[model samples]
Target chain A: MQYRISFPHMGKYYIPIKKAMEAFVGNYGEVILPPPITKRTIELGALHSPDFVCVPFKYTLGNFIEALENGANVLFQIAGDCRLGFYSEVQEQILQDLDFDFTFHMMELNGKNAKGLYEVFKAMNPELTLPKVVSTLAVVVRIVYAMDGIEKYIRQNIGFEVEKGGFERIEKQFLAEIATAETMPQAGRIFKKYLKKLKTVALNKPAKPLRVGVVGELYVLMEPFSNYFIEKELAKFGIEVERFITASYLIFSTQHNVKKILKQADGYVSYEIGADGTDSVAKSVVMAKKGYDGIIHLKPFGCTPEVNSIPMVNKISEDFEIPVLYFSFDAQTSETGVKTRLEAFYDMLEMKKRGRAL
Target chain B: MKAYLGVDIGSISTKGVIIDGDNRIIANEYLWTEGNPIAAVKGVVESLQKQIAPEVQVMAVGTTGSARKLIGVVLNAQIVKNEITTHAIGTMSRVPDVRTILEIGGQDSKIILLRNGIVTDYAMNTICAAGTGSFLMSQAKRLGLAIEELGEMALQSENPTRIAARCTVFAESDLVHKAQIGHKKEDIVAGICTAVVNNYLNNVGKGKRILAPIVFQGGVSKNVGVVRAFEQILGHEIYVDEFGHLMGCLGAAVLAKNSGVEQLFDFNIQEVDFVTKGRECELCSNNCEIIYIYRNNEVLDAWGNRCERGLSA
Candidate 1:
């Protein structure tokens, strides 16, 4: 049976995930990237989802439905901390109730019999060996790191580019070129070529530009469409953007450094506050100490972990005297409200900068 | 006699002002938006034009408010700004030492904190539109009272009743239950005002240090009942400028003068036919709704597309 597998979108991480899935599925099936998240996708997701589930649930469920509609027979969802751990089971049940015939695979990261990359790939294709699985996973990890590295550079300098759309044009080339790479060396070479191309993009940066740090829930922070492409909006006003959470950081770095993250928060948060909440608090402290002009906190409406971090983040803002703006998204279709608040926030920052200079 | 023109096109009302180079108000007009900001702005500009002296030429134009971008294009504005900054600038020009601003408009409310004439921190009400001007207007209609009469009636209360102000749905049911149980009408009115003030403080004003010399503005500031409730709760004097409702446009005028870009702002914009059409691009799943502004049947500007594909559409 041809297994047409699909997964939800989360930024450009799809490129790497699709690459890994292709190797895992082998000749058994093909990977179907769900149509890019659109207004219709969100509306369909919200219509069938539980009335007040976190937005990522609705988004992923919508992606699954679209994929199923497009002839996908298998869906993959990764288990997560917070409400995300229970998502796959509920989503599978929801899809079954909708009468779609498909297989649902939920990968667990932590348990007595936790499923790792090799186990997951082997389960999908019994013909796959340990060496091939390990090699493909290595290439996938490199792809994610390169994407994140290039994105970090883009966010800092995109606003100051001498020629408009120059950085974005190169980014599109990077994603397209990296997708065709078959081996680890190919992936590494592609990344280096793009990084050099990105550097050559002429920038008209000022000595001091307005800087803002973004810290928030894992899903909304990573998914640009989910948050109305806010980082791009900030760059339009020439504000240098700094964000700490990335797929690589969360997967490879965060789990082992939970205690260190909490300690770095400087007593603002002492215990694990579930998922990325502690990380959000900790990054705010680091950003504030770094003298960022402002901090933007984003979260899905009623997200427990991110919501839990607000009071502590506010306290940090007060003590550090840095302005923090908070935004909550819930199946939002209108961009006016977000733009209005962002512009006001920018105006305030500019005035504050002028005042300080005086 | 060069003058600056500023227009504030908001959800509820459209306000306009013309000021001399020294920032003295030459002419101003305030009118209801009535769901048609373009027509309302034309009305405001025509009225302001009639009020201005013939020798005073309108130079640079600035726009601020919810519909600022659309109206800015309509007027060939030198600067299109958000209402928060415009309000702060307008208020500071009048009350230079103002440390805080409490503003509640039709659909939104915000708290802006300033120190030494620069905005330090600010927050606008999020998600919930519980205790804004529209909230008061709806409750007034339920009570079979004119919106203007609500403040006078509220001020007459000796013992105000308590109503839930956390959410509009809850507040409405609570108000009905109070009335059903024979709560005095005046007391209920006063309670509603207090509820609006409380909701603003608890939500928009939360976690901020609201220092002294605070100025209150927006459509809600005209309500003496809400103003009194604010005073009773904060225990601080709230100064409502005589030109409180015009502050947004006043700030725009000031910004235009300071922007150093002088364009002849013809009052003849009232005669120009402007229309906006929204087209939803179906090329891909991200169906971006692109808005195109047409002036005299010619495409002037377009926005709201997420990608270049929609630009062509």
Candidate 2:
């Protein structure tokens, strides 16, 4: 049996590519990485998709189309929050509409939907044993956890380093070394060494360098695709960046943290900001009092909660004498404009600090 | 002597509201967004600066809207919030007992359910523009009637026609069909109003229990026809505040006041020149277009990126 496996885009290709190649080679044949996402892929997806569908929907459809064209008989996609959960059926319809010969397996499509998943696996790997599939999934989970751990540590400390590019260089080395590691222990060793080296890179600056806490809508913050890399750019200016949003954090600790965040705002107001507004406002206030240099809030073009929380944030900024910058991202927004204002804000803060000393 | 500044930037319009500590509206201006939030915000800020009394200093600045962040950043706002929270706060302050909020703006509509003065559940339709202010504007244009006259014109009908109220395509076709059949102008206007309300009810308010006292807001709240249609469909009286379009801005002002901490903010943003650039991410199939902002050859901020690929770069 010649099995075909595919992975999407850069960075994710590292582990999945290795794993797929190993697993398929061990069983039957070879693995092929899906063609890079291009304008053509998006066009194809748009052509086949329902008009005015969300951009993600069109892109995912295009990915599947490209994968099928590359002779991939089996497709894998991780299921999660938002519209991604329902995208599989929609994508399947579009694929079937085009009459592609392929089998689809969406992991986490309700754990109880085991029979359907098993049938898909059986078709892809007729000699597949339940134990083997479980073990493969376990390995993949471990790799994901390890990658996430490395990413989390790097994100928090990368901005604090005294020397520019030190963290990134080590991060690159760590990724390269980890990719070559055959076992979890080797990946762990690589992570530990790089983390130590990262800590040693002195990040000493003025005791206070306009610490800006970025808090707002999740998509505009985490996805980088959505917010246009605001956090990284802020970090480049040596601003101590604090953003408490991530897919992992949202899934694991959001419910628990939300209560704590709300409780922190006890005396100010009891109203919620709809969706994540409450959380953003709470976090922004906390950061304001924490003596952070400034606060930068980001949200999507049409998001509601962030819109509601602006007043509260302004009040906090007024009360604390701290500056807060807000940014809304959309397709037409100019990055040049955002950066110019940010630099001016940074300069103004620096001037204020100098004037106070005088 | 305490004063607050509120900036509400929506898809279609950007509004600025200045209020005294006693919650009295001092100065307010509403202008079309013209598809550029940055320019609209700049216009709002410039207009607001001129409106402020020389004797009364701006104690706090708050921003709310779809473009709150960008505007907040540009204006150096003290507080920034989402539209729902801003609207809820604004409405609760004025009408204290609002249980439901039906906000239909230029490009979107939202049905917010409030229980015991707190937002319990809410649904928003941003993808579709059929039952929003734009829909009304389109119909008004087709009928050669100004949007402001739609409500009273609709109310004038003794016998209202029933038009399709699904997607824009079906609604437009039904309207043409009704006109071809020589339906009275008033009846057609009433039918269009009912159609828009029906579309909103089926899409945004679907699967949600709407209870009163319901508050209708956003730019479309000014349309009495929509308000009447909502009341007829939900079988409850709907209230539209005099300053309905300014609710988000009002909420932002209220929040600004409640924020106990006082900071001296300088509104000198106009003195600085800001520039921005755009790029596309090639790392993922998502191909998210990103923009990078620069000030004096230094990267000030970046946005529009989808994932981590372009973030660090």
Candidate 3:
């Protein structure tokens, strides 16, 4: 039996993890989900590591430790920018020092070439044929495409749904169905059906609630784990949530769409926040004028780009007369405090709306 | 007879300044980001709208900051530039003899080394909070002293004690230890100042040749204690311009004036319909989840990219 192992990303950008796992599982056997992330995990990593390492490094290291404890011998990591590429080695050394027995495959280390892909596949399944690897990759690609399409549709329309929990319930069902789906056609059908249902729910003949746009760092905004499930919590308040950040947009549509977005901004904001602050600022203005009630800004602690953009964002808020609630997330942030503030913010908006109507 | 506006957006603050043909400050606003760039810009614009003379229509606008591209798009700014260029231009325009610039803001710190008014080497500590304004603010809060008072109190110290000038955790414990040993509050405050200055020098200003005629700006420039600390460390009387906080905005405005461009624009950014979505970028292993901004139904801008792959700016 082959055990499938994948690390946890801060959010839905888990596609790469999923893709890597699929390739490994096809060659090996069943894939095991990595252990859940927690404060203890982070502590474990921090205790064993240097103090200057970034938070992601520590969290990932903790994740690997937990996965190994759960009998995950095969570890998968994708090499990329920043310290992440180097983290694999450091973490490997740490794990080895702790006397854990495991095999690690670093994808993208030799560059994303055919040879690297073949080597990874071969490492996972020494007896597997090349045809099997190709077929498995094709299936993984299809899954990724379907998942992206479904999520994109959901993001655009989630704010407009007339029935509360309809979109979320469907999304939950869709994720589960796709995870275990046997064929690409089956997953496609499930996606189509859910998309139709979501559209119908969103377009129901009724007045929509006040839409509040959320924008900020991708990790904090999209990953419920990182930001304490802020989006889900916001939805529970009956406020329509509009968010314009997603992985698909960055990877596929950024080159074609950023220019159009810039023109739309029309010189209201001076720059993008960090990497995405510009997008958040432009979207906040659009939502304000589009009759949205407020804007919520989020960012990871120590994010320089967002920090630089705050002044401009405040300017947008003042010019539009829109109230914006800002939150900075770190590992030590208190979830209870965040919830309390969010609830109060919603109440304040509600009171303002009532006063205006009266 | 046309005037231009320049907005400098930084991680810690947003600044806007207006200038006439002769490069005089017509209007300006400085505000804390509080983690909201859109709101911050809106505040700057509203303040500018009120401050601008009724007869002087804003002919052109330029934006520069970490968020310059987004703010530029939102404000219809004609030119957007990096903080280094914007800050240098703004400082050189004010203090032409400025050979070194030391700027410490809320979240980050920068050291600009200049030769003959040209930036030779510069380093920024975007990742550390050890030496920034926020660190000092928090330390002040811990000491139960107002941030404004800490600087003045430090000036009063006859014998400044030494505190750990490394990380926040170490510094905090060190401060407590010194206080427990009956160190005077004034001396402790001075120690804190020295620690912050030392931390900045070690982390951001390391291995860089800091020249004379230094200009210290950014949010931290307001602290007289930090100014004194720098003077003691660098052995030079640092120049803090009357409008030091507004230098970035001034620089952006200067650029706008130099470009000789005119575009009729409204400061009312509230009327525009914008939306944003956040997703993870899975193109490579980086998995950089990006935020996409949209105006109406069209994509307006994108940010939160670790690499330049997803953004044009």
lDDT of each: 0.90, 0.70, 0.72
What's chain A's TM-score in each predicted model? Answer: 0.95, 0.69, 0.75
What is the alpha-carbon lDDT for the whole of candidate 1? 0.90
Fnat value of model 1: 0.72
Specify the CAPRI tier of model 1: medium
Candidate 1 per-residue lDDT, tens place, B235-301, comes to: 9999998899999999999999999899887778866889999998898877778899999999999
Candidate 2, superposed: residue stretches over 4 Å from native: A1-29, A35-44, A47-61, A64-358, B265-288, B292-300, B306-313
Reproduced native contacts, each prediction? 0.72, 0.02, 0.00
Can you give the lDDT of residue B153 in candidate 2? Answer: 92
How well is each residue in B236-278 modelled by candidate 3, as lDDT tens digits? 9989888988887787887777776778777667777766678
* lDDT (Cα, 0-100) at A295 in candidate 1: 99
Q: What is the TM-score of chain A in candidate 2?
A: 0.69
Q: Write model 2 residue lDDT over B1-313, tens digit each, in one string.
A: 6788888987779998888887778888898899887777677767877887777677788888777777666666778776766777677778877888898888878776655565544556734689888888998999999999999998999888899899888898899899989999989999988988999998777656677788898888888887888888889988888888898898888778777645655555565665567887777655667877665567776777645677775
lDDT of 3 at A19: 54
Distance from true position, residue A15, model 3, in Å? 22
What does candidate 2's lDDT look like per residue over A57-136, in tens digits? Answer: 56557767887898876666656444556667777777888899776667662323335544555666667666565555
Q: TM-score winner among the candidates?
A: 1
Best by DockQ: 1
Please identify which of the two predictions, 1 or 2, would achieve the higher DockQ against the true structure. 1
Q: List, for all models, the DockQ compared with the true complex.
A: 0.62, 0.04, 0.02
Candidates sorted by DockQ, best first: 1, 2, 3
* Interface C-alpha RMSD per candidate, 1 decimal: 2.9, 15.3, 20.4
Query: Which stretches of candidate 1 lie above 4 Å from their native place?
Result: A109-117, A254-256, A356-358
